[model samples]
Target: MKAMVYRGPYKIRVEEKPEPIIEHPNDAIVKVTLAAICGSDLHLYHGMMPDTRVGMTFGHEFIGVVERVGPSVQNLQPGDRVMVPFNVYCGSCYFCARGLYANCHNVNPNATAVGGIYGYSYTCGGYDGGQAEYVRVPFADVGPARIPDWMSDEDAVLLTDAMSTGYFGAQLGDIVEGDTVVVFGAGPVGLYAARSAWLMGAGRVIVVDHLEYRLEKARTWAFAETRNFAEYDDIVVELKRSTGHLGADVAIDAVGAEADGNFLQHVTAAKLKLQGGSPIALNWAIDGVRKGGTISVMGAYGPIFSAVKFGDAMNKGLTLRMNQCPVKRQWPRLFEHIRNGYLSPSEIVTHRFPLEHIAEGYHTFSAKLDGCIKTLIVP
Candidate 1:
């Protein structure tokens, strides 16, 4: 099997690796048909995440055909076409029973925080991801769902992470009808969050980013007002001015570790590895939202302290809600939305790479070249 192996920071290559086999009674070996390079994967590519060992494959958003299933995997068979959520969990755990599968206590040894995530790092449970021809899925019955007959492979793959997380961001916001929501970042998650805000009854949506291309996508695809943070002297002030000086009703941080607005924060977090992740987006979110509003954080961050505006959030009485999205929890509504033509997840896809050229795919995406919004790898 050929898989993308991480050698070091900014280094990855497609190489022959041993095929995965069922290791647990609830496991299934999936032959990956479609996989996506998520924006969060760049954290590993750039050495932002801790304990991302060399030779580990990095990918979480994927869909596949089950080639073999363990005896305990009763819900699926060898020939089932399935979409596996990024989370790896046991369904009967205390957290899982409460629909908090992303925090399942029975999966990751380091269950103090996030549960097992496919191909994230040792901190999130060192599970191999599906950035290859084959991947072993643990707790297969709980995580892998059969792809709906009406769904396309591209859409199914994106739903595994990006779309689901975006919707979860909006869900966390608890947007009231006619509320103004501002989303920071215009990546796939940001775009989806902006779009989902509308579905949640937000009267207006604003997407903030530095890239013109992504901001354009925010305007067209998400139907949200766009702002280039680079163009503003102070983005929070600009957001406040745009929202009639009170601030937005809700703000979401969709850009995590690599946020670029504050040069010092970016350097401290991304370049120097000082804090967990740059809190520029989150701080902007806190400052951009009105008093007593909500702030939803869907961005991926490391398990370390970040210099955030906790004092200001407390002063303003903001409701801060966030989690590594319970991907399967959002599937039912997402399936309905896709079925009704409300969303075409694949429309965000801008590049496709063969398994052999995954390095090129990573480079293109990491560099944000060729107008790449989303890149898919066909294995």
Candidate 2:
């Protein structure tokens, strides 16, 4: 079998590897039909994440047909088309019972992490990922959601992770009817945040990003108002001005890094108070929120850590939540949404390349060429 293997940072290669077989009583073997690269994969590419081991496959978002199932796996059987949630969790755990599958006791025995990410790193469990010809889906009965008869494989692929993350961010942001929400970054996740916010009945959704292609793409096709981060002299002021001086009801930091601004002034904002330009995205989110509103974040982090202005956050009575996303909890809801035809996540896919041209697909996607947001690898 052929698989895309991670040799090291910035060194992913397509190589021949043995096919996967069931190793657990609850495991199932899936013949991958569709798999998409995720932003989280970038962490592995950049060597920013510590858990990514060499020679491992590195993708989590995919939909496939069951080639075989473990004897204990009864809910899903041969020929069943399904999407694998990014996490590999047992449904009976304490966290799973409370709908916090990310922190599942059965999945994350290390207790250092909350959720299991496919091909991410050993930190999350060194599970093989879906960026291959076949994948061994552990705990399939609990983690796999059935793809609908009406949806295509490409459309159902994102229900595994990216869409679920966006939905989680929106749910945390408290998107309600008539509320205005601002989302930072127009990447795949951010665009989905805008979409999810709209589905939750938000009155207005604003997507912010510096990339002209992404900004235009979000506005034109995704149905969200957009702002170019590069054009805004001050995003917070711009958003407030746009929202009639009251700011937005909820602001989401879909961009993990801080943008340029008055960060030095409030250097001591927390204990350091760094103020003026504290990562414009978070600042914009903090400032954009209306009084007593929420600020949600879905961007991956830890490469660079900054001092947060807890006092400022507290002053506005803001609520903050950030994570790798509790995909297990959102899988069923996202599946229902897809079945009902409310959100089509596959629209973000701009380029497709055969498995033989995997290298080329990586180049185009990494460069963000010609409105490319998400790229899929076909085997």
Candidate 3:
């Protein structure tokens, strides 16, 4: 099998590797058909995440055909086409029973925070991810779901992470009808969050980003107003002015570790590795939302100290909600939305790469070249 192995920061290559086999009674070996390079994957590529070992594959959003299933995997068979969520978990755990699959206590040894995530890092349970020809899925019965007959492979792959997380961000906002929502970052998650906000009855949606291409996508695909944070002297003040000086009813941070705009923050967090992630986007969310409004954080950050505005949040009485999204929890409604033609997840796909050229794919995406919004890898 050929897998993308991480050698060091900004270094990855497709190398021949041993094929995965069923390792547990509940495991399944999946032959990956489609996989995506998520925005969060860049964290690993750039050495932002801790304990991302060399030779580890980095991918989480993938869909595949079951090559083999263990005896205990009763819900699926060898030939089933399935979409696996990013989180690896045991369904019967206390957190799983409460629909908090991302925080399942029985999976990761370091269950003090996030649960097992495919291909994230040692911190999230050193599970090999589906960035290759084959991947071993643990707790197969709980995580892998058969792809709906009506869904396309591209759409199914996105549901594994990006779309699901975006919808979860909107769900966390608890948007009231006619509320104004501003989303920071125009990546896949931010675009989906902006689009989902409309479905949740937000009167207005605004997407903020530095790139013109992504802002254009926000306007056309999400049907929302767009703002380039680079254009403004102070984005929070600009947001407040746009929202009639009271600020938006809700604000979401979809840009995490590599957020630009604040020079010192980006340098200290991304370059110096001083904090978990840059607090620019999260701080913008706090400042852009109204005093009593909500702030939803869907961005990926490391498990370390970050200089966040806890004092301001408390002073303004803001409801700050954040977590690694429970991907499977959003599947039911997403399936319905896709079936009804309300969303075509494949539309966001801007590029595709073969497994052999995954390095090129990573370079293109990391550099934000070719107007790349989303890039898929066909194994």
Candidate 4:
């Protein structure tokens, strides 16, 4: 089997690896048909995520065909097409029973904050991911759903993580009718968040980013107002100005560890490893949303202290909601949205790379080169 193995920060290579096998009674071995390099994968790629051991693969979004299944896996069998959610969890856990699959208690002995995630750092559970030719799926019946015959393979892959997470971000905002929403970062998640806001009855949506290409994507693909943070001396002030001085009713932080607005913060968190992650974008969300409004955090941050402005949030009485998305929970609504022609997840795919050229794929996405919005890995 060929897999993308991490060498170190900014380094990865395709190498031969042993094929996976059914490890648990409920496990299934999936032959990956399509996989994606999510922005969160960049945290591991750049060494922002901790416990990301060398030789560990890094991918959490994928769809595949069930090559084989354990005796207990009755929901699926050989040749069944499936889209696996990023979370690995037992469906009967306390949290899972409450619809919090991302916080399942039965997986990931490393931490209690997040459940098992494929190919993410060991901090999320040292599970090998689906970035290779085949992957072992644990608790397979609880996480994977059969890909609908009408859904394209591309859409199925995105629904596993990127699209689901984005929609979850908007759902956390609790947007009301005619409310204004501001989304920071124009990455795939941010673009989807902006688009999902409309479905939640937001009257206006604004997307912020430093790159021209991504901001352009915000305008065209997301159908939202765009602002290049690089153009404004104070983007928070600009956001307030654009929202008629009251600030946006809700704000979503989609740019996580490597946000690039404050020079010192970026250096301290991203370059120096002093903070959990750069709080530039999250701080912007705190400052840009109206007082007493809601702030939804979709960005991935390490489990460490960050110099966040907690006092202001307390004084403003803002509702702060955040968590790793329960990816499977969002699929039913997303399926309907896709079938109704409200979204075409594959349109954001800007590049594709074969399994052998995944190293180049990572470089392209990490550097934001070639107007790349999303990159897919074909095994």
Candidate 5:
């Protein structure tokens, strides 16, 4: 079997690995059909995710067809097409019972971590992910859902992370009917966040980013009002003006920490840098929002500390919330929506590549070239 292995920073290789089999009675073997690169994968690719450097398969969001099922897997059968949830969890844990399946105690013993994540570290329950010709899926019966016959893998793969995380950002922002929302960054996740805000009945969605392509893309989605940071004097002021000077009911830091490298990047950076999990966006989000607004950070974050102004974030009376989506917890409802045609994540996937062309896909996605909103790795 061939797998894309993450050896170190900016390094990936297609290497031969042992064919996966049904390892446990509760496990199933998936013959991967399609997979997609995620913004979260960029952290590992850039060597920013400390514990995930080596010994990882390098993909989390994927869709595959079940080739073999465990003896105990009653609901799912071979030949079933399913979207594998990023986080693997047993259904009966204390955390799962409370609907916090991402933080399942049995799957991930670490209190600091949520659910055991695929392609991540042991802290998240080191499970094999669906980034290869074959992958072992433990607890497969719990969350895998069949892809509708009408849906293509290319159309469904992007939903695994982009839509889920985007919706996660909106949920974190406490979206409500007629709420004014400001989403920072125009990456795929940010685009989805803007859409999620609208889906949740937000009055206005203002997206701030320097990329003209993304701003234009957001406009096509009717994602709030778009702002190109490079073309604006003060996004906060502009957002206020657009929102009747109330600021936004929600100012979300979807940029996470790395969307801008330093505070200068907030307004005056001379070059474009890949922004994933930068801390500067936090303070900017705090300053950009209303006094009582919420600042939700759906970007992938590490434990390492970054510099921020306590006085501003505190005095502004802002609420802060950050987390990876408890994807399994939302799968049933979200899948239902997808099945019912209420959600169309396919609009975000503008790029696709075969497994061998992954490097080019990464470069294009990383560079955000030619309006490359999202990329899929067709296995």
Candidate 6:
């Protein structure tokens, strides 16, 4: 098998590797049909996530066909096309019993915070990802579901992470009817968050980014107002002015670790590895939303200290909610949204790369070149 092997920061290559075999009674070996490079993967690519071993693969969003299953995996079998959620967890665990699969206690040894995530890092349970030709899926009965006949492979793959997480971001916002929502970052997750805000009855949606192409996507695809943060003297003040001096009712931080508005924050966190992640976007979220409003953090941040505005949040009485999305929990509503023509997950895909060209795919997305919004890996 050929898999994308990470050598160091900003280094990855396709190399021959041993094929995966079922290791647990509830495990299933999947032949990957489609996979995606998530923005969170960039954290590992840039050496932000700790314990991301040199040889580990990085991907958490994928859909595949069950090539084989262990004896205990009764829900899936050979030839079953399935979409696996990014989270790896046992369904009967304490957290999983309450539908908090992303925090399942029975998966990761360091399960104090996040549960197992495919290909994230050893910090998230050292599981190999589906970026290669085949991936071993644990707790097969709980995490994967048969891809609906009507869903395209692209949609199925995106649903595993980006779309689901975006929807979860909006859900966490607790948006009320006619509320105004602001989503920072126009990446796939931000775009989906903006669009999902509309479906949740938000009267206005605004997307902020530094790139023209992504802001353009926000306007056209997400039907949201756009702001290029680079063009503003103070983006937070601009946001407040746009929302009539009260600021947005809800704000979602979709740009994590690498947010670039503040030069010092970006350098300290992203370049110097001094902070867990760049808190510019999240800090902006704290400063841009109205007092007593809600903030939903969909962005992935390392488990380390970050210089955030906790005092201001406390003073303003803002409700802060965040989590690694329980991906499978969002699927039922997303399925209905897709079937009803309210969402088109595949429309955000901008590039496709064969398994052999994964490095090029990573470069294109990392550099934000070629108007790249999303890239798919076909095995």
Cα displacement (Å) at residue 79, model 6: 0.4
- Model 2: runs farther than 4 Å from truth? 257-280
lDDT of 2 by residue, 236-322 (tens): 788889999988889888765323335443243222322212355776688787778889977765433455666788998998887
Lowest lDDT sum, 10 consecutive residues, model 6, at 261-270
Runs off by more than 4 Å, candidate 1: 261-272, 304-306
Candidate 5 lDDT score relative to the true structure = 0.76
What lDDT score is found at residue 17 in candidate 5?
A: 85
Candidate 5 weakest lDDT stretch, 10 residues: 267-276
Query: Model 3: residues >4 Å from true position, as ranges?
Result: 261-272, 304-306
lDDT of 6 by residue, 150-191 (tens): 999999999999999999999999999999999999999999
Write out the backbone clash pairs for model 4.
Answer: none
TM agreement with the true structure for every prediction: 0.98, 0.89, 0.98, 0.98, 0.90, 0.98
Q: Which tens-of-lDDT digit does each residue in 235-262 have in candidate 1?
A: 8889989989999999999998767635
Candidate 5, 1-379: lDDT as tens digits = 8888877767777778898888789888888899888877776676655456475787788889899998999878999998887878788888778777667777766746677888875556777677788889888778677887877676567666778878888988888799988888888888888887887889888888898878888888844688887776766677777777767889877676446565553222122223224576676687788887888987776553455666787888888887777775555556676778777788778888888777777778776776787888877
* Candidate 5 backbone collisions, by pair: 102-115, 116-124, 205-224, 257-277, 257-278, 257-279, 258-275, 258-277, 258-278, 259-275
Model 5 residue 21 CA deviation in Å: 2.8
Off by over 4 Å in 6: 261-274, 304-306
* Model 1, CA-based lDDT: 0.92
Clashing residue pairs in all predictions, respectively, total 0, 23, 0, 0, 10, 0
So what's the TM-score on candidate 3?
0.98
lDDT of 6: 0.92
User: Across residues 1-379, which tens digit of lDDT does each residue of candidate 4 receive?
Assistant: 9999999889899999999887789999999999999999998898878788999987899999999999999899999999999999999989999999999999989646888999998889998888899999999888999999999999999999999999999999999999999999899999999999999999999999988999998999999999998898999999999988989999999998868645665566567766656787888999999999999998998854657888988888899999999999999999999999999999999999998999999999999999999999999
Candidate with the larger lDDT of 3 and 5: 3
- Order of quality (lDDT): 3, 6, 1, 4, 2, 5
lDDT of each: 0.92, 0.78, 0.93, 0.91, 0.76, 0.92
